[model samples]
Target: MPLTAQQLQAWSRQEAAAAQQVTTATQASIWLTLWAAFTGWYSRPQVSDLAARSVRILQPARQQTGGLGAAYVREVLAGLDAVREKAPAINLPAARLGADLEQVYSRPAEAYRLTYALTEDTAAATTAAQERLFTLVRDDLTVARRDGEMLQMRASGVTHYRRIVHPELSATGVCGLCLAAADRLYSVAELLPIHDRCKCTVAPDSDTADEAVSIDLDQLYEDAGGTDGAALKRVRYQVNEHGELGPVLGVEGQKFQRQGDAPKGDPIARARRELAALEPVLDSLESRAAAGEDVAGPLAYQRDRVAKLRAITA
Candidate 1:
């Protein structure tokens, strides 16, 4: 039997609620570790040591989320009798977390160095360092766990997924970037591109789903009322390769610091570069669409990317 829109939405909420519990615990662990490090609890107090300690605190939380992720996907597949296979386990090696944490730790280290040189007060120096470390640690820890779950979900029987933007899940509400992506379906092979503190969860698409549920962006923009056409055009959804976290969602002008890239060129140049890379994909989609494949969603997305690229290059 095909699942109704309401049933799909209900499942999304249930999965999101379960994921939120783990997110809360992981964030709590980050805060507790940061508090202990800033205080005199750690005798050494090196930034490297702080990163190591934070990763250690988060290991159990990561494992829990991974397990939940596998179970969630397994249950979803089993419900549809899609496949009898088990969902793959998430393998977030400690070394990977440590490497990423080391980069985040650098911000606090630089803050402490600069502040101590200027202020000459140990208390002020430590406070500045703590303030810098707080956000980085929280965002990193949260995203890392989410990324691991996403990886597991992709390898599982989930072929397609849709974004669920529940404003109540986030205190700040949804951002325009996420709002722009709300109406589309994404393949599970793609990373659920996220910004820091993104509260959106994904609903797995059942082969027997009766309807594609999504937010109406046109109505949403109309309610806002002041954004002009140019402003609207700025909401280009493209994924950039992040140095630590693989593919991250960003708008047209946003630049990502790739792990081993030389200095990124100007925005137009980057757009051209991306367009060149996307050409083969667009060709493949066009071929598929012409053959009567139901590829309207993906084709529209690619066409939009090409249009945006041309606009930039112009």
Candidate 2:
């Protein structure tokens, strides 16, 4: 007999398999990195090269940058371990959403019973959830690395960290959130990434912080007072957590904040939320374009805008 929608939704076999993959894979990768860091540090000369020793012992810092730190390795490991525990919690909501969707679509469209995209959408959403879960894990690990390595620097008399975002195609010619704040040097613990997916590398900054610099500008502009003459290099539209384009009034040290009802933390999550909010408009625009209307130009422009917004997280 064919199972009813309720019966199908109640099935856990698929969910179990998917969840297990996300959980185990994340844990394995983290441990593997830790093992490599341990081996590298352990194999190095144990003499007075405390800085070199800190890199391997702290681990993630070595993975992020060839940097070192001390006294915080145990805490950082515990923090990274917590990412595994967070996986199931993240998966649960995705499971419920998938189940509800399957229930609705695994039924008859007319008198004759039918089934359609329900199963596929459910699976796709679950996979998306798993990918996002991994993103969170990576973000947490980045923050942990910064924390641990900062301790090592503090102990070794290293003073500052210069935030450097590894440039990629999407981020070309743009300063990400952390890099925006790199106008002046920061204390070892200070120059960490402001938010998730912010893989800005913080190397030991030799330049002193709070120093004055001079520059010549050809045009008059908003003169936000700072000793360093760090003027706006370029202007890119700022999108908040809700994915709405709003005023960024952004200076080097000021972090971006979402206005309106957008959920806080993780700009990418906000952008996703914004995209979801725009579905009706997107569908309409797409429909118009398909019907051979003039929406192609507008649709393309809107899509390009949204794509840039989405890439903020990337």
Candidate 3:
């Protein structure tokens, strides 16, 4: 009962779609957390109380969606069992199941920081930050929900898996880097590389690398016009390792800031740079305040932050 590549592709598409549904469920939970944040739920509480409350609100989402994801993985494995029943049933550890929950839950706080740092207009900044927060939560949860399936695939005697690119499934079509890697076998030990709203799926393979289905690499070159072309070269070599997202597709002149890569400079120097950047914002706020505009709250917050930065730099 050997499975054909087309058969794998079909399964991958269906599973990828189902994964999106799971992601949608995760997003609903995230929206509630975001609403709580915007409504000042986290602002008025003690840190310890906030932590406890956050866990209460987020834990159910984690458990419910995690259970669903694990069940989905088991169902997928059961289907693959018809072809080869070598995989053993195993449960994902509880710690691993909710590993990313804290990070996802902290996004609103991160957005709060970003809202202040980005713009002078509080309303506009808040809107932008909230939008970014939703996107980040959605993307990160997409990966988190699939963690159980990936872990099970590796543990279930799967030697390798194929990356199926479903560009048609997402509005943001698959990038060339993914396209280059698609339809090819990767070791199950490797984490699947993904980007924002990626709809790719990995199909477990019991076969050797040599027996794995192959993809035409030259087709990318053909699509890029020729082998010597810059576009083709970038497609082949611009792949980068992202600390948070695993492998990432890169174009020319692109840079990545990995997790914990921030706060790089000395504290005083960083503070000085921040103060320098905030000068124009402060001026704008001051002019608006003098014009009888009702920007006192934002003005005060900015002035206080500037004072703190100056004290540090001094």
Name the 10 consecutive residues with the lowest summed lDDT in model 3. Answer: 208-217
* TM-score ranking of the models: 3, 1, 2
Per-residue C-alpha lDDT of model 3 across residues 187-278, encoded as one tens digit per residue:
77676766666666666664421232343233334433443435433564245676554565565456666666765559898888788888
Give Cα distance to truth, residue 138, candidate 3, Å.
2.4
Top TM-score model: 3
The global Cα lDDT (0 to 1) of model 2 is 0.35
Which lDDT values do the candidates have, in the order given? 0.60, 0.35, 0.56
**Candidate 3 local accuracy as lDDT?**
0.56
Q: How many backbone clashes does candidate 3 have?
A: 0
Question: Who wins the lDDT comparison?
Answer: 1
lDDT of 1 by residue, 1-314 (tens): 54455565556556667767776666556556564346332233565676676667766766765566556556555556646546575675453334665556556656664454344355776777766665554455446445655665677646787666554455444566777676677887776777766656666765433242443233334434544535554577777876655556788777777777676668888888777766676788789789998656446656777788889899
* lDDT (tens digit, per residue) of candidate 2 on 90-169: 11112111223222211111101001011213234334433433443443344444544555555545666554333221
